[model samples]
Structure formats: structure tokens, C-alpha cells
Target: MRKSHAFLLYLALSGLCFCGLLAHGLFKKQADVEHLEAKCRLARTLQLTDMCLFTEASYTRHLSQADLHTAFQDYPMSLDHFPSGAIVPPPEIVRRTNGKVD
Candidate 1:
């Protein structure tokens, strides 16, 4: 009976350890996914900003008003402010607010 109890105790401990390891792995995977997602979001924002800036710079260099108009037509600029709903918080802003960019 004592040997049987020992066996049962060992089994329970092993099960508990397995559960702990599984939880740790899941937590790690979740953290990695969140980090990658943040990086992707930052990259997207940078791409959009770069495109807008490049288009604006191109528009500024034209010698003729007609050429400027033509360029502007090809790459239209929106004068409206970015909607709050659509704006992703920049990494810097996220860092400032959360004390970590996460």
C-alpha cells in the first residue's frame, strides 16, 4: 500500500510539472506573437509615412505648374487629418504611455 501511494504521488507530481511547462511554453509563444505584431504595426506606419513624404517631395521639385499638377494627380494627397480610429499609436508613443513598447 505504501508503494502504491508513492506511485500515485509520483504520478501527480509529474502531471503537475507537465502542466507548468505547458503553461510556460504557451506564455512564451504569446509574448513572441505580441512582439512580432508590434513590429509589423510599426513597419506599416513607417511605410505609409515614407510614401507620403516622398510624394510630397516629388511634388515640390517640379519646375512647371502643369508638371506639378500632373504629378499631384498621379499621387493624390489627402488634406484631412488621420482619423483617430484608424491611427495606430507609434512605437514611441506606445513606449511613452506604457513605459515599454511591448
Candidate 2:
């Protein structure tokens, strides 16, 4: 019942809980594969784009589809209006092209 022992016990329990969650998710994902595949097929048929990551600004919501300037729509020196803009880096295409559209 010492402080160190108590902290060690808490860490052990947290590790066990983390492993249990990972195992559960692995099995659950296996069971849901068919359903997920069906959803993906439907999306393909509907010509859906990549899944939305952030729901703040349009640029943050769909980074892949957003133009580089969308983040600076207000002005050239305008700060990002959405926190997600700071969190998510510009898309690979924008980075590769250096913000130049093809």
C-alpha cells in the first residue's frame, strides 16, 4: 500500500485496459469488414470524396480537395479562422506543387 506500489498497480491496470481495448477493436473490425466494404462500394458508386476529418472550415473539413488559398480566403496575411487549419498541414499536392495549381 505504499505510494510507489499504488502507482505501479495503477499503471498495470491501465496497460491491461489499453490492451483489452485494442483486442476488442481488432475483433470488432474483422466482424464489421463486410459492412464497411459495402459502405465503401456505395460511396464509390456515388462518387464520394475522401472522408471529412475536421468540421470547422471547409478547407479543414476536406484538406485533399481544398485549394491552398482557401485557408487565406479573407486576405493574404489573414490568420487561420479555424484551429484545425493549424493542426492539419496543407495537403500533399499543395506541398508538392508549392501552392501552384496545375
Candidate 3:
């Protein structure tokens, strides 16, 4: 009977620990969603792309049109977009009817 009581106590403690971990995960997920929503709102207000909605913990950054262009250009050359390889060449902008980038 004593052994059964100890086993039940151990099981109850394990269940409580599992519940705590689950609650922590839920809280973390909710925080992430809230963070993304805030980012999306900022993107809409700034006329930025939806790529601006996601934040990378490894490389947090404020979004800009030029930054988005640079990232897209770099993505093809990168291995997971880790920001540590093959530099992107400068864009060749020809923005006029006369093909003038200057």
C-alpha cells in the first residue's frame, strides 16, 4: 500500500510538470502570434510587404523596401538565409524611358 501511495505521488508530480510545460508552450505561441500581428500592422502602415511580418530571433531587423529587395536578391545565393555568405551584387537600376540609372 505504501509503495502504491508513492507511485501515485510520483505520477501526480509528473503530470503537474507536464501541465506546466504545456502551459509554457501555449503562452509562448500566443506571444509569437501577437508579435507577428504587431509586425503586420506596422508593415501595412508603412506600405511594406508581408515578409515584414515575421521576425527572426537570430537577426531581428526593421523592414524597409530596400531591405526587402536586398533580402530577395540574397535568398537565392544563401543557404537558409543565414546572412553569412555570398554577398549580393548591387542592383542595376534603369528607371527612366531613356534607361538612365543615374
Give a tens-digit lDDT track for model 3, residues 1-102.
Answer: 699999999999999999999999999998899798998888789986435333552222333223324444445554436343123322223123225534
Candidate 2 per-residue lDDT, tens place, 1-102, comes to: 899999999999999999999999999999999999998998899887767668878887777888868868899999888888888888887787874654
Q: Which structure among the candidates has the greatest TM-score?
A: 2
Please list the residue runs of candidate 1 whose C-alpha ends up more than 4 Å from where it truly belongs after superposition.
38-102
Local lDDT at 2 for model 2: 100
- Can you write out model 1's per-residue Cα lDDT over 19-97, one digit (the tens) per residue? 9999999999988998978877987977532322222333322212123233234347733232321232233333454
lDDT of each: 0.52, 0.85, 0.55
Candidate 3 local lDDT, residue 72: 41
**How much lDDT does candidate 3 score?**
0.55
Cα error, residue 98 of model 1, in Å, equals 54
Question: TM-scores across all candidates?
Answer: 0.34, 0.69, 0.35
For candidate 3, the clash count comes to 0
